[model samples]
Target: MIGRGSRRFGLGVLVGVLLGFAFALVGASPAAAHATLASTDPPQNQVLASAPDQITLTFTEAVRPVPARIKVIGPDRSVVNGGSPTSNGTKLVIPLGRDAGKGTYLVTFRVISADSHPIGGSFVFHVGAPSIDPPQEGEAAVTKADPAVVWALGAVRYLGYVGLVLLIGPMLFLARLWPARLSRRVPAKLVATGLGLLAFSTVAEMYLQGPYTAGTGLFGADADAIMNALGGSYGTTHTVRLGVLAAIAVLLRPFVRPQGPSTIDLAVVSFFAVVGLGTWPLSGHAGVSPAPAVSLVADAAHLASMGVWLGGLVVLVAVLLPKANARELGAILPVWSNWAMMSVIVLSLTGVAQAIIEVASFGPLFDTRYGRLVLAKVALLALVLVVAYFSRRLVLAPARKALVGAGGPADDDEELDEPPVKPLRRSILAELAITGVVLAVAAALVQTPPARSAADAPPEPYSVTLSTDLYRVRMELDPARTGGNSMHLYAYNPNGEPQTVVEWTVTATPADGSIDALDIPLLPVTADHAVAEPTFPTAGDWDIKITLRLSDIDQATVTQRVRIGD
Candidate 1:
């Protein structure tokens, strides 16, 4: 009867989750990806008539500027920014020095997105004419956090997850299922240890955020960065989490005692648990998602369900099975099985909801890092469920058969023969081991950009300067992918002055000779400037040959190779 009911419940849960996912898909719209450059004043690679007083950058989302990281470098390789960059929602305005020169200028910026991820990139614009050699910052164009800090943050997140499982499981079992004759010492110690680990991990994460966002080493966070971290939404949620933990600690004092918790104490602790779980989502991708309310509730429920189910398994394998006698096991196993089943149902439902909101489409699910991790997590969870099923069968089948043989149902005082313990323990242990790996994957998922954002992210612009005996040609390609690309060409004399051109001819051919050379038509805007829209049919290396005619007698051709990506 128990097995049949569990199957029915599982089926209903699966149907409900599928229905919810379908509805989410129907209502879903394209959400803004990570913070990306949407547009810029004095547009990249363009030759402006004059230098503007300021440059404005529009991003896909609101961002907080990183100090000392946003600057404009003039043609003379000197800082030309007049003042600090100011942000108005998604737009950032950088004041340019009044004396900015008449050559290439590089604008580099680094900022933190609303979701706590750092984004950095650079672009170039020309004043009057292109520079003979543009100012370069090398790898500093795209700022990156230190490897040690990244690894440490991931480890701390995983530690927090482990603590949740350990703490939630034992405390729950002690309150409801623990036998009166058994000592509470071991379970109480487990609860204390879990609490300590959680507290430590939370404090560590708060400190790590400063360095992580600053693109610095683990110990490189300065006073300003630390203070900024504390002032942001990430810091606010974590601070609330610490407060919630403190309240839980005080309320739990009576809960883990031998006498168990009073009804009022249980209600208060439950309230704190919901608030605590909420902090995890409010500080992550969910807080900035398209459906923030739905994402928050789903994420919180997912955490709670994971904590209860995995934590319960730990308590069952380590403490209950080893110590409880036949009659005690008969009474405890059935109730625990029911709770585990319910927790799994909630976990599955919330996991599906989050995937729908974050991944959005099938293409991203199969193409992006975030989506692939989700697949790996699902595979691991399925394996754990298989082991859980076997474990449940072992417990229920024996307990039911023994009850039938003993007449109808055994009373609380009646003794029943113990079921096989060794096999059950092995199955539970296997479940816990797989769950640990799943937790690690979850920690990684939190750090990765969502599939929707990764898939929608724009490709980097490609630019190159080629030289011939007669002249230098700089070609700029916007989003060099397998599609129509806007191309701009600027001609300069060997002495770094604008060179007049009478005619321009351009053609592109695949490096492997897969296709014949295709002529690209160019329209001249000035004697030294021309623009065209060229289409690359496929993704691979292509050779572009440009023939310029200074006069009938002074023509030169330059060939440059460019790579196009899918």
Candidate 2:
């Protein structure tokens, strides 16, 4: 017959699988978490009468360009960039050759965001008209990281978290609550295994960083990409973590023995633990957060508390519960309970602070993918806490009575009754099972872009096609707000071929009539294309009248109502 504990464990596993499936569904589609291209001069797919003096790119956030990966291919399939590109905060400028003749120009670029993630993409613009076949590069414009590498990186990170739990839990138990009668070999081996895993994960992460950033396969990172990866903050932190692990290994040899860690050894280990933990946040989103100091400290504390709580449970369930007697349990359970409570409090507080900083507002908490994952984490955490409450009650009530009545009363009849140990073990197992899913959610959260950045992203430009008796006019207004807006106008015949426009004129009049009609000047770039910069004085609906003269005698005017916002 299946036991109740077995059924509960099965149910927990089922719930975890369901939650993981839900998260996978939400996060399956890949999206860029690094800086996104906001606007480009001589915008993509635009056709100019002549090549511009320079090509400028603006990103949502500041980025460092990979000089070797930034290239401009001219119509003649020759590199046309005049010199090295210049970066000024969020803008990158590439000077063009003076004598450049272009049909279509391809600009491919790769840049590193401030948070150490990489972003790459390509865009095309024409001089007179688009090429029959636009210039294409081999792999310079590959913006998506290899799927295998991405999955491998995520798996390595998960293993690293598991290693942290294993190392921390056994080390703490051996130092404080370990029974004198039980052999230390098993727990010692666990510590060693955890340490080895951490070392391996650190090295694997370093090697994978190059390919992850370069959007290449596992073995595709070039020497230059690898060198650049090492020079960045991500590589530096991983290197530091490896060093700390080495030092901890040396310091831990004596600590795991029967003699236990001395006061000085404990202090040094604690300091190194803190430094090692700090590296995690310093190399991730927290390092580049709006409030870096608070985020760094909170993220570190959150990780530490998680390690303590989860690791302690592992030790209690694996070694202590099975080996220790009733008397040993009575003495150990209360202390572990206190420690677990404290860790839970710390975890909850730091998690809330991180959510506030990363999500910023309630809208994003439900709207963004990052926010949805945060919600999933919270739900799983709540489930763990509920299970923990039952576990705590079972431990404190019976264990405290057992400790108080030790050696005073011989209650053979009461001892024959059900022991709390079995139920407590079941509860702990459920908590661990659920928390495993929580950890997976946390790992996915690290890969996702924060909700605040997604919320702050600018909306797409407004575009409309207006038709008249003679020609169809397509107008695009970038950032159609109560400010300066870049307007591009293209004229086409009824059959959709480019229509030659002899002259073009534009005017804007607000529906509210709060201001007089404003004349907008248009710079004709080609026979069928014109560009203009118009400033809206206030926020309201405005009617833009476009006059296009197809021939000297044949002319038509079209008016389109555009809503402009502040």
List model 2 lDDT by residue over 25-82, tens digit each: 3444322333778889988768788988899999977887776678888877878878
- lDDT for model 1: 0.83
**Candidate 1 lDDT trough over 10 residues, lowest sum:** 400-409
User: Can you give the lDDT of residue 392 in candidate 1?
Assistant: 75
How many clashes does each candidate structure show, in the order listed? 0, 0
Candidate 2 — what's its lDDT? 0.79
Superposed Cα deviation of residue 453, candidate 2 (Å) = 1.9
Error of 2 at 131 (Å): 7.3
Candidate 1's C-alpha runs over 4 A off are 15-29, 139-142, 400-419, 512-514
Q: List TM-score per model, in order.
A: 0.92, 0.76
Highest TM-score, which number? 1
